[model samples]
Target: MRAAIPARIKLEITLSYLATGSSYRTLQRLFRVSRPAISKFVPEICDAIYETVKEYIKTYLMKPYSRVSLTKEQKVFNYRLYRARRIVENAFGILASRFRIFEKPMACLPETVDKIIKACCALHNWMRITSSNNYTPSGSLNEEDIDSGHIRQGSWRDEINKTLPSIGTVGSNHSSNLAREKKDRICRYFNGEGAVPWQE
Candidate 1:
């Protein structure tokens, strides 16, 4: 009987596949594993990693109101919200640029895809925390001009945009009362105590 592949090698293989989106054949050449074995184990490894680290991945679901006319407070709120959204986009842009896997859609089952994404997110967070200097060097991410308050696009944006399509804005007319209340509170805070000097 053949000896089993070690757990560490399996993990390395899975991570390599996720990071590069390389084909099994390519990975087989690189890792010396059979393509069929790689295909069978990659998804399982992703699922395991995702399950272990999914709790570290938190998502906030909030959308700014899509309207033309707005009050000053609402405008301030929107501006702040937009800035926050930009930060998030930049983060994903960095992730996509670093991990070529996200440059294109994964050709896999939806569940497997979800696992892959979760696993990648966990790994991204880990790298950011442990090796922030190497992971995100100066000027690699969007920067705000102190004097002009203008955003300087990051290099990651150029690389990511080459492969990914621009995201479209989705307008919605419906919002729950609780969500509205929360948005109002946040708006009030931004316009009031939380207001930044440059936001004026």
Candidate 2:
């Protein structure tokens, strides 16, 4: 639909789908590409991004955030990097699930896929700012759950405290009714509703 846009821009659109796990059907029409082409693109891009970002993440960011170091600066840096990864990965997972595209082969694109990955990260930062609050553990469930599915209860608040966005939300400037509705859907997920707006 938005032709005349630079190829770089199209890449970003494609990356958004990958990071958020959006379906080919959602992107095929938008990109004017066949489903098979999209299927081919995502995986090719995944390696490229990991190659480009992994070094930056491990050295400048992750190394500094280490808590095991005796130096206070090192500890502080390590902690920060640790928290940042959590925030970033959580957002990626959110995108993947919301878009429903995290399966094999689909995540293989190249520059286009990288663009979508960045866009998903950017969108996560955006929503972090706009949400009414950083997600709170409202129910009896543990507030902090590792990917292993182990839920922690005692220091949940402490875990939240160590989180990157605990002090402030990320996006406070965007205004779109569609975005709001999408957020509502996400909130429902957080609430453990297990229902989709499309069903309603």
Candidate 3:
């Protein structure tokens, strides 16, 4: 058997692949490492990160309740959940823009792709927390003042289409129905026992 590659080299290769979406052969040429070694360590490191943070993932990704079971107040709470989805999408957009690898098609197995994404997300959150001063979104407002009573507009498409869609939460599949149901339940919980005094 060949000698083992060092952990530092493995880390650099894995991160470079995730940041650039470079093919294994390309990475092999660039890093002077074998394609097999690159493939092996990248997924291994990603899986380790995922396993380490699985609990946090579960906590943040709780399922939503269905809409059919929602009360009027519960429905309003559910609407807030829908609004929160924009935050997730905005985070994704920021991640993709920062790490161009996500912008390109990932030419790997689905499981491997998931691991890479999870690793990147974990790293991104860690970086944001540990080094908040170093990173700023390009052409956006100063990151420092974002949370300082500044109203940020999520989109500018209202001028293009003032009318809202006619449909009202019609799902095309059982999974969608289940997700809606979960949201409604969460909403009910929030508006009732889960609510805080400060919430309007």
- lDDT, candidates in the order shown: 0.83, 0.47, 0.66
Q: Name the lDDT value of residue 188 in candidate 2.
A: 46
State the displacement of the C-alpha of residue 49, model 3, in Å, after optimal TM-score superposition.
Answer: 2.7
Better lDDT candidate (2, 3): 3
Between candidates 1 and 2, the lDDT winner: 1
Number of colliding residue pairs in model 1? 0
Query: What's the lDDT for candidate 3?
Result: 0.66
Winner on TM-score between 2 and 3 is: 3
TM-score of each: 0.85, 0.35, 0.67
Cα lDDT tens digits for candidate 1, 49-157: 8777676677755668677898888988888898889888888988888778887777777887877888888877778777988988888889988778898988877
Top-lDDT structure, candidate number: 1
Clashes of each: 0, 30, 10
Q: Tell me the spans in candidate 3 whose CA falls farther than 4 Å from its real position.
A: 53-71, 136-172, 176-181, 193-200
Q: Provide the global lDDT of candidate 2 against the true structure.
A: 0.47
